[model samples]
Target: MPHPTGPRVRLRAGTRLRTTLALVLLAATLTVGAVGVVGVVATTSTAAEAPRTWVVDAVDDTSGNRWDSVDTGTSVVTIRVGDTVEWQFDRATQGHDLVSLAPSQPWETVWPTALQEYRDAGGPSVTYTFDQPGTYRYECSLHGPLMTGTIVVVPADSTNQPPTADPVVEPLTGPAPLVVHATANASDPDGDEVVVAWELGTGGAPTYTDHTMVEYTTPGTYVVRLRVSDSRGGLHVEEFPVTVTGTGGPGTDPPTDGALPAIDALAAPAQGTAPLAVAFSTQVTTRGEVHPYSVGLDDYPSIAGEAVLVRSRGRTHTTLSVTGTKPSARHGSVHVHEQACDDELGGAHFRLDTTQPFAEPNEIWPLFTSDASGASGLVEVTKAVRAGPQAVSVVVHDPDNAARRIGCADLAPGTADLTYSWAFGDGTTATGADPDHTYATPGTYTATVTVAHASGEHAGHATVSDAVTVVVGAAATSTPSPTPVPVVDGTPPRISRVGPVRTVRTSRPVVTARVRDAASVVSKKAIVIRVDGRRATKVRWDRARGIVRWRPAKALAPGRHVVRLVATDAAGNRAARRWRFVVRLR
Candidate 1:
């Protein structure tokens, strides 16, 4: 047996024991020879045993410290007694020595200095076999505390054969609320029935099974264990490491003196008109700390709306109503944006106009308080800031650290009250949300409507209807009035010129088409071109010249290619043309 914390003595053959064994064997052989002419037979049997080997390497690299295990690349190793551990030095410019130290002992006093071995490039490897069950701490004397390692030794069983356990865990690292599937492949050499058990590091009753699933609610490193045992008292244990990471949830750091609460959710409107009255709702979770906080349209003394401070708990829910008067003068429109900073207290300001000073009094929206649980609020602006498609967003910030931004939301425009203006192609016009007009004499006419919103304007055409037509006498008389001429659109858009219509070897040859419509092209988006049945890449339309240009993103294969062009006009009329050309390899 070896001392619990001391190095074990190496096993070596002794001269005295060998001589005594040889003499006993010789005496037995002589006695058999003297007995008679009968032949004497000699047989020998010995039990076979070998020590397990583990390796560590020392290298001078920033990837890892000087001393790292060659097998696992970590500083820790677990082994049974009678297992050999070897340390090899591979750095040519640095010399390192492995020295054992007592618990809480100074590094200058390495116990049993005779056992320490220094090595460098081409140096001999040092080997040691542990014979005691205890944690052994060692370090490189040259590198001081920078290089350190630990070895955990277990006592070897001499009675029944111990079982072997192979443990596996999937997705060892992830965010909180992590689910890990743990399984073990265990076997007993003595053919004895083995029992497997699992224990989670979070402190719960151990589970008896070969396979089990465990979930971690908090963020931290958890040690999961698998144990196997035989009826004859042989046992084996293996460890699985799991790491969970996140800002909040269970298993996170316990509440400290100044730790901030977490915000769970926030809700509010994105856009509203003047005299906006907003109901802001919020939910937060605290870390067992007393956090008397306020909710309002902005942070602290500069708040433009309302701020109500209330005591919060592990889970808190509150709603605050914030109202603001709309600016009388509209310089330009300003967006209500939310900037989230969970780590710090500073965020960007809402600027409605460059000439106006940046202050919460001018802007009505709130900057959310930072919290890991997440915080929410609502704000109502009584007046419109600016018009014409203003961009709005909600910015989220960390409660504890206001400078850190954690999340955001881009708000969509609110519904608008619209006014419609209509033009009947029969030379008649009307204005109203919904207008009623009668045609006196009409054969065919195109009706169009233009709608105006608070921010912008849009126009669309109405479907043709039979109610608009009037028949004034079916037959012509001797003194009949002049007949009305019906408006007609019979001309289609014409393609003035097209290129690459013959042949080309370059795969990326440019294809151009000059198109024009008598009425007018609806938009550049109305033009489309395809090559070989596939849409061409980078299709651009030059509105000034009515030219559409496109090229293949990839080189065209060597073959005949078909190009198609489609164009549409404001009258809802469309024109299409197709042509073919050959592509040759260069």
Candidate 2:
């Protein structure tokens, strides 16, 4: 049904409940005016009071007619005393009457006679002038609680202007448990004293003060609001946003020049055997200020006393002790099990067990952690585990709270703690943990295998057969030649025709070389060219033709340039050649 006074005031669809509570509170604080219908009269004054008109639209829909306006949108409107408000009713609506619900009148009292006339003539609109400075509550008698609004009337005097509030927040972004300083600059035109209150937009009891400091325990974006009210009841508000990063501890310094903390260098032994204990170290550096750093192992507890508090741009080295026991032999085979955890001490675990059920036993290593940057550790390998191909990896959880893999390093075969290379003495060599080779021509050949241990300083060689003789005889008519056996190519690539030892020019000069191997070149990346110890840009390699070409992207600065070329074949054999050339600008 349409409200008699026009349409009922409708709250936004989603906020009906909140709007109702707010209107009830507003009704309790407002003062009701006299409800009798009075004749409109023009008052004479020394200066003409030009009346301002505000429109309260009466809209029609399936439910009924609704009151709408910028002020009606929020269920309240503000106006100076003596300003006029027009309640324009839609002609097609019916049964809606604007009634005063304030203390001075009953809920059923109809307001302004123009509304009554509008019902009869289908054209009359009602206008009301507020003469007193106070809040008045009104509603449509027919629609009851659903149709309601408030009018806040202020003194017309210019001296009653509201205070202006300006808020300032310092060090807006930092690590969690961030401390933020907030202050407001507020002023009232009438020189009235103003009270300032602070509110955290996320929710809490407001703090009353002009300047205050607050701490945010969790990492997120928060809004800090300042409300300033003058003695005359005029109010103003402003808000400032603060961002808290989650990278480090609360005591950590905020970023400057906007750079993040990083792991500079990590050093550790690449391989280890069973019953191995290794010490690893890494340097953590920050572009700006520093904070506390920690190191932890995958399944083990964090090194309790290893936290370092950094305050400047210097690097801090953290050491970790790791030990791995020999794998247990089961069913004539060895099995090693390892696991990684989410945190230093607790959380989910990453397990690696090759002998879980029906699976074959494999070698596994535990991962490690060092803050959010990187981690390092060691795993032991026994002769049984080394007999076959195995998979190994180092895993670290993501620092951004993403419960997934952060960093991983996969270990492959032949990259273990020990390597063996064999020389057949027939100008052919093979390399692997265990390799086999067959001589093409029958003759006495010396076969020797050199074992290179991970401990760089230790290596050993053993003669498998000093002189193995083979005699070739006429083959039977139907007999096929012995199947060829594959052997590892141990010879490195050879480099030839390197030049332009010296050149004077303004343009970049190209360095070219012909590299070859008895077997074959590895790939385009097999050849690397460096100028002045730095990898040269725009390197091109023709693998089929064994041609390597490199040219600097920019013109060479006139000076002595050292060019070095390193080439490797398919079998991991590497050879390097260097040249010094002088370039002078023309």
Candidate 3:
């Protein structure tokens, strides 16, 4: 009984007090230890969680925007205790891009587009990694001189994992059919390759898979979503709105024939005469714009009967001055000649009737019309004459427009040859039937012969005249015994046919003679027959034939001509005798 009261009360009270004190001490100690651990971790992690961040200058859609305006600008960032970061440009136009100025950097870019386009718009960038805590410098690759930025990281806590950053969405804007290409610079502190997938055009517009490039063949505005995944399985998604515009490149070619095909100008004048100074010229339908062309002249037969040569002009338009003296006129059908054209062959043909005056044969003996049919020109001379047995050919016009032998004649010196036979002036012809007639006197006469061809009697007729002088002299004057007219024993000079019986161009006439003597034979000399009214020559006896023949030196014009002989012998002996004879001049 004594213990029950004492044990119960004392025991219960003492147990409660000790239990309270022990509980308080234990709580205080645990609180103090936890505080110390947290402080130490905060200090260590704060020092470690300071992320190495590079400030990349960034621009926005409006006019332009930059990450910082100062050398050291601020950007709030959170990363793991030991993570590296490289900040660079994310958007651009006309040659803008991103770069990190610091050495040992990681990310860099030019205006990231198609590789080909990128190469064309050159820009290279820089990169860096964060091992310890510090702010880093970065800028736009294109506008680095104007851009500056920085980044800051805080300490890690119970919730130490950093929030996944959205993938950078840069909607490329340009002319369409829209084509876009991009490069992923996503990196992980865990050292892993980045994988990027794209879901294009939200709102049922279009969708794309994991390709790096996307094309919108159609025209429209679209919201593009890009999902980027890192090696650590961290994923970031971003949406970009793009507008596709449409246009194209430039057009070239000329018009077709329908638009009034150009009419090229000619190179030479339309009408030009030969032996004339002709200037060549032409005009085209189109405006003065120049084109290649050639020129020519049709030279078949010139109007002036001349030869012409075409020449080349250095320019499209040229002054062509030519002398048409050597070319021939168009005598027959239209003779077409081609002068020049753009090409060498088959140019336009033209006809020039170079109709010059016909050639006159009398003026120019052998009137040569180049268009003559003969192989060669006709030959011409004065006129021919023949003596004894002879054949004569007379010249006249032929069908070939040439002078040629047309008539022929044959004659003998007998009564049949007294009058010269005319071989009519043309070949294939014979005329003047009054042929072969002896002249009463010996003299020269022009025997004219006119010849004609088959063309016409007078059309192709030719005239030929010859100077015919005849030899008619009185017979040698025969001196008689001088009637024994006593004279000195000296021989006297005698006249012989009175100086060869000079004859006149007339009928048979009388003749007289005179002789000179050493012993005054002139007084004893008697008058011999006056042959052709002139003194006759004296002829002495010839011992060989016992006869004396009279001969005249020169000839006279033929007609009814005659001659007589009278002579004085030696010893003053004179005798006069007259002989009649007819001389023919053929």
Identify the leading candidate in terms of TM-score.
1
* Native-to-model Cα distance after best TM-score fit, residue 349 in candidate 2, in Å: 60
Q: What is the lDDT of residue 502 in candidate 2?
A: 61
Q: Which ten-residue region of model 2 has the weakest summed lDDT? A: 18-27
lDDT per residue for candidate 2 within 1-586, as digits (tens), equals 1111111234323232111100011111111123334455453212134546556654444433345553445444555555666665653243345555433321112232322211211334556775545555565432223345555455555345566655666776677788888777767667889777777644577778778888887554455655566766665544344656662111112212222222111112212232222222221221110111222234222211111111111221111212121112111111111111112211111112211211222222222333221212212222221211112222332232112222322211111234445565668766642344544443444445444444323333311221112222232448677886987788888776564476533234556676766455567767788888898766777664355766555556778888899887778899999987776542
Q: What is the lDDT of candidate 1?
A: 0.44
Evaluated at residue 19, the lDDT of candidate 3 is 6
Residue 492 Cα positional deviation in candidate 1, in Å, after optimal superposition: 73
lDDT of 1 by residue, 1-586 (tens): 2222212212112100000000000011111111232222342212123446677777665332345565445555555555656777665334455666564411122222223455545465666555444445676533333355655554443344567655666667788789998787878777989887777766687778888998887654565655576775455554455657663322111212222222111112211332222222222121110111222223321212222111111111111211121222211122232221121111233333322332344343443332221222232232233211111233333233222222333222211223345665558766642344444442334445444332223212222111111122233348867777965665677664575676654454557677766445547777778887887756878664356767664556878889999888776778898988776642
Model 1, residue 546: what's the lDDT? 57
TM-score of each: 0.26, 0.23, 0.16
Deviation (Å) of 479 in candidate 1: 65
What is residue 526's positional error in candidate 1, in angstroms? 65
TM-score for candidate 1, please give it. 0.26
Cα lDDT of model 3 by residue, 157-276, tens digit: 322221232233344566556677644344444455555555565224332234456776543344454444454324333334455544211111122222221111111221222222
Ranking according to lDDT, highest score first: 1, 2, 3
Q: How many collisions between residues are there in candidate 2? A: 7
| RMSD value for candidate 3 | 53.1
